[model samples]
Target: MSAQNTQSGKNDKVDDVSGIETTGHEWDGIQELNNPLPRWWLWCFYLTIIWGIGYSVAYPAWPLINGATEGLLGYSTRGEVAQDIDEFREASAARDAQLASADLDTLRENEDLFRYAVSSGGSVFRNNCSQCHGSGAAGAKGYPNLLDDDWLWGGSMEDIAYTVRHGIRNDVDDDARYSEMPAFGELLEKEEITALVEHVRSLSGEEFDAAVAAPGAELYADNCSSCHGDAGLGDRDQGAPNLADAIWLYGGDREALTDTITNARFGVMPPWGTRLTEAQVQAVSAYVHQLGGGEEPAN
Candidate 1:
């Protein structure tokens, strides 16, 4: 060590105590060792750098001004997904064709088709209708509950299919089940609106003021009877809801009823015919029908 230090350059320092070469730099009392890297470790690092270069050249890499670089192999995630979708559609072509043309009234006679429709409809409902109607199909405020017997429109399988295809109060379809309630805010006084609220409460068997409800009987007869009927049984032909049933799309309370009488409800549903395929519309309609609210076609 002492002989090597004598032969070393002026820049190379030697530690006095250990008689070993130093890097001519120290931190406090310690000096760093300038040892050569292990040959195996160095080779492994070089291989990794080579692999990275090769991977970049052989695969999608390097973002350009317009798009990403395409490799020689020309693989794409979108192309792969599209191929898988095409294959799936081809496999189900027979079933889809049968479903698209099947009659809703007789579709249930074939157990296999019925089961397929129900399952497929459930998937469609979750994907499209669940945002408004709820995941469980229980519905929310202003969205009618599907699990109950009460229905604004007829709930027969055919009726449901028509509704799903054309929708309610939608402007896109000419045959959409159309109905409009005159907004009574300008037509009736505040007291009349309040009376109507109390009367509606009474019709639903809720607690109400008999005095206010008495005046509302005449008011309801004159204004609401045309659509809602004398007993508030609701006319499905006009899409009028049963006020006596207590089940409401919106709340059945005083505040909700008052607002409804004053402004009137103008709920709109988009025609799914424009968006979903015919089979999907029928499937989703069938899905909603079997949710326990479906009714038999009128004899």
Candidate 2:
């Protein structure tokens, strides 16, 4: 009998032995319904099961005395990873060479090169800066926004390079840029601090006592003006905050402002120059510049 005829005969005999009748051709009160599994599908399923058994035996599927079973084929996930990294390096050699050779400004002019830097730098930012700056680079209180063009230190490629090389408040750094916003807690009484807070708050049009602000004016010049500037516009070189701006690192609330004055807040940004290569630092700065709201500063 042909294969088809043999299968049909076996199916026909199944109904009688199983005590099931065929829908049309019943045998011994046994019915064989029209439902039948495809031969190819069943075979494939069996083959996959057999393959799985063989794979489990040959591969590192089971844990042993010291480690997992080393596959007979000697396939290793770590080896595969290393191989992938080598492939990546080989593929990106041209780009890496360009980055190494080119200045940050020159690289930024090339959109493709800039994009490559952003992708590479994004990984580094996520690993390091994301803790304070957030995954989106939106800063928490006291931490400045990386997305914005506004930088306490200058935003130029060279400027960023300098800041990253020598961190603010990084005392361990021999060449660290240092500025201390004197604590007003000892200088001013509780009521006087409240007046200054009200005055600072009024700069942004938040609720404040005008009468108290008048008195606070003199105090601002005496203590804060040395760094924050006469107009309260801030001195970027000194890393002094612009009290006039709507953007507040700490909360703009009266209590927060009062606290800030009482015990001056110093925000510290870690230097990346020590940890990362020059090219890597440049890439990160470029990526940060691409974050929304950043713009080229006037020469």
Candidate 3:
């Protein structure tokens, strides 16, 4: 009734059929064969070890206390990339100089330079201005549409360039374009604000209760007309938007209009003068101007 194998002595014997030695280890009376690895595979394994050692000595592979080990070749991928960038910039220097200095009025005469500015500016816009202005430059609720003629500031290339360089309502730059709209909720009663909102809506041709808008007209004249103009045409000098036009920055809806009047809006744009090169500013301006909204410079 014993469970142990009685043929344990045969486990270590060479297989007579295959003439191969057995490993002497067995499971359930099965024996494992002892076989050497192929010579080609063994040689490949040795070659890999040699390659790893050679690579460590010839390339920047090992880390050191302060930096990485400058291998025998002393090569750096980052340095090579930087060198390539410098070469590219050097090649484009002359074109950039022309773009930076060319008068805004005369820029259109040089077709090649104008095209270059627009192309370069498109790249700059994507990197810097696209977050707020959108990839297509259509703009959002609070942001002004670059494809429209309703510019808060002037729409000329020079004006656009100036605005881009100095920015709007940012405190960091002293030369930044600044404007403030008083929060009328603090100065007027709820009834007066409601009436004024109706009157403002009427200016844009929105249907409103005639009785409500009548009182609102007086309130608008007393509080908003100076900067917005008596006809609501807007003053470019003060950066007042044309309320009569269909374009609305925040929204033209009643609730959105109410919130804007109650809280007031002070949208701030970061100055790009300190952030971007003068040439870059010019390029971006050109790109924006060509977006079908730009106007001829005023004589």
| Clash numbers, per candidate | 0, 7, 0
In order of appearance, the predictions have TM-scores of 0.86, 0.73, 0.86
Q: How much does candidate 1 score in TM-score?
A: 0.86
**lDDT scores in order:** 0.87, 0.76, 0.89
The TM-score of candidate 2 is: 0.73
| Candidate 3 residue-wise lDDT, 114-227, digit = tens | 999999999999999999999999999888889988889899989999999999999888988888999999999989989988998999999787898899999999999999
Runs of candidate 3 with Cα error greater than 4 angstroms are 1-7, 10-46, 63-67
Q: Which ranking of candidates, highest TM-score first?
A: 1, 3, 2
Instruction: Evaluate residue 62 in candidate 3 and report its C-alpha lDDT on the 0 to 100 scale.
Output: 90
Pairs of residues at least 3 apart in sequence or in different chains that clash in candidate 2? 20-30, 20-31, 21-30, 21-31, 21-32, 22-31, 22-32
Error of 2 at 280 (Å): 2.4
Give the alpha carbon lDDT tens digit for every residue of 1-299 in model 2: 11123455555433444444345654665445655679999999999999998998777787889988887877889889999999987998788778756676566678898888889878778887799889899988877787776667677665665676677887667776667787889888998888788778777777788998987887777777788878778888788778887678888998888888999888776777789876677667677767775456456
**After TM-score superposition, what is the CA distance of residue 1 in candidate 3 from its true location, in Å?**
22
Among these predicted structures, which one has the highest lDDT? 3
Give stretches of model 1 more than 4 Å off: 1-48
